[model samples]
Target: MSRRLRRLPAIVLPLLLATTLVACGDDDGSDSGSGSTDALHGITITGDVGKEPEVEWDGELKVDKTATEVVTEGDGEKVAEGDQVSAHIWIGNGTTQEKAYSTYDQKQPESVQASNDLSPVFKDAIIDRTIGSRIAVTATAADAFGEAGNAQMGIGNKDTVLLIVDLMDKQVVLDGPEGKEQPAPSWAPGLITEGDKVTGLDFSKAPEPDRKLQSATLIQGEGDVVKKGQTITVNYLGQVYGGKKPFDESYSSAPASFAIGVGQVVSGWDKTLVGAKVGSRMIIALPPAWGYGKDGNPDAGIKGTDTLYFVVDILAAS
Candidate 1:
């Protein structure tokens, strides 16, 4: 669950006013309603949206809705009362041109329910929103983001917020073990012969010490050639090269399935797993650039410059 901090209404009002003045240029002709069509003047993209954005606050603010324009987009399946939904959202300052927040942080698209905590506006805005429908909303600092408005996001008090929300799909979560973690796979007791081959790597090697993110070999599994976009599963363990021990690991035999080449995995996994084959045992050395950046896992005693090692197995591919 995401951490939500609600600001006091008193503290919020002054910040909201400051952000509005700085971002919206006097607010001389702005509307008062949170759903005003003419709230935003324009929108722009500052960087490549295809990559994992370093910051989400670079998209320009653009609002072009007529007075009669309704927020509904006739695209997604009708959102039932308790349906599950996921989205790629972008929030921007209409006047300052700064981005405020987004869900692009998710390696995969984020999943949310129709609960109040997911998004206050989504419950009402998405009732009629169809799949693939694009919706844009312009709301005042208070109306859109409640008391924790754009001021906290670095905007002035009166700054209108432009929210370009994409309602991707509505899904029903299976109530059983589909969402549960799979059990670990057992290691083959016998020696891994030619049957153990690399799954996706055209080449494999030991990672150099202090390397950012390099591929490592798994001790078991057949190294069959794997292709991009294929889903694969494997069990693995991660450790700091010279530190205590494996602080993270997958189920022993149950490898996780993920779409390769896509941003589904971390930057290192996507960069190194290009042509690896299945049934292969490999090790990887990950540098801070390829691993977690400055914010190392304090609990694991991994520092910014520390390298990581992983013994991975390519058990199965889809």
Candidate 2:
């Protein structure tokens, strides 16, 4: 991974949100009805569509079977089985009365799969629901994490995990920059590309090196402008100027996600990426002062005096 970007949690969905959490494999799963049949109806969810909801309840909520409730109906895109949905999830321990996780805190929504692989409690809650919907799920540890339970989260064998999910919109991921090509900057290094893919940065004919940071946009995209403290996704390639090859790139592994303009990434990326729009492709040139500093990323073979350059494709921002 490029040191210019910050690495999100090793697990993007927290507890691998794609894995099965319930053992209900035979049926299509059960969707709880309104009012009495709603297992997680005790908790209150309130908020505008496409945003994280506020959850509240008077007492501990426990359910014998995996219970799901459609907290609110959505008016956005319709989803189907196995399709990926952009959702904000909040997990809490009903037995311990403590909150476990919330996407609001992370400042981004997770891409959850509405497929059979998901737990019965979650799949049943989300299936047939359109974007902008809100679903609440309640299940015991036996039904959620199985018998052993998640020790790190402090959930005992009998504890239950409560989740409130807001299906905001469909996830938008890009394989490359989806923007119009612009004239390359004369001051920056030449971009070597094989078709739509960026291969490396060639600084052979570039201007004399300087310590100050600089940036240039190669492709202009008309998408939402990125802001400070928002989590953004991008495909990037980084190299030490004058080096033969790139030190790291997202083409091989895929797009990476992290908080931007919040010191989570190097200062060069934080200052350059913000105010840019999604789908734009930009290049940045920064000296050691704005890169890894005196302790230039030795693991990537970067030296203290290495002048770093990066080619980035802004994919998504939230």
Candidate 3:
């Protein structure tokens, strides 16, 4: 699902200007006496093979290269044309070792994966690379995400990045019954049961395929079933059906609150919960159409066309 986002922070322009100034003033093998903008394009990169990459092949886990490292290594397995892989990765500056973005920082080392070849930053390089292999990919600031990239990532104009990745597993897409079936998982408060799973009680309709629609159900409060513009709070956990593997959860620290039917939630939730009364617990089983869709999370090892389940607890509506 796509939703237009808020504008970039006002300070982004200032960061871009500062990076330009720093690039112009550097005299250490950078910049020409001439005033051409081409100097900004001269970024050099180098790296060490942190340690030999550990590798094993079970036929399922195959890479082009059996032996791989950072500076010099083997080209791991060839990622099948459409296969998606999951990985654990750490990124930093290849020259100075300054840590940039890291999966460790999010405390979500396994859930971060990439599947797209275009626009997605992590795609292309790691796609087609075998499991448990390591590669150092270098991209220009222009090649990254650009100005928003610099402000959001804190990378400088001439900065070079080194991404150290560990391939974990590859995900396979399932069609029809081939998909795993999940029984209901353990439930917390305000949950109701239809089958083995618990669901939110506020919605009036079940899920619909290939269309967008809104339905509402009531819980405890008195108001129009979550009106179009009202702000609301909800708690939800996203899990793979049949496997009980949770991909995302908002129940760890506090229940999540957002505007009803807004882009704050995925299109599936927005369409399903518009009329749901607050305090009603509902369950949603979403095929890939309502979930991550065809481009599954390869980095987290999710395949395209996978089914997903969610348990939602409505905490507040405003």
lDDT of 3 by residue, 204-289 (tens): 23232322222223223332366664445555666554443455664554344344554444556766767765555555656656
- Which residue segments of model 3 deviate by more than 4 Å? 1-77, 94-97, 105-116, 119-121, 173-318
Global Cα lDDT for candidate 1: 0.47
In terms of lDDT, the poorest run of 10 residues in model 2 is 1-10
Tell me the tens digit of each residue's lDDT in model 1 across 169-263.
66433221111122222211111223332212211232236453455443333345556654455555566655444556653322344445664
Q: What is the C-alpha lDDT of each candidate?
A: 0.47, 0.74, 0.41
Ranking by lDDT: 2, 1, 3
* Candidate 3 or 1, higher TM-score: 1
> Could you say which candidate leads in lDDT?
2
Question: What's the true lDDT of residue 203 in model 3?
Answer: 26
Off by over 4 Å in 2: 1-4, 7-68, 80-86, 106-128, 139-159, 171-175, 203-209, 229-231, 242-245, 297-305
Give the number of the best model, judged by TM-score.
2
Name the TM-score of candidate 3: 0.36
- For residues 1-118, what per-residue lDDT tens digits would candidate 2 score against the true structure? 3443442332444334433334434333444645536676467767875566666864877677677777787888777885656677888888767877677777777655576666
Cand. 1 TM to true fold: 0.41
TM-scores, each model vs. reference: 0.41, 0.70, 0.36
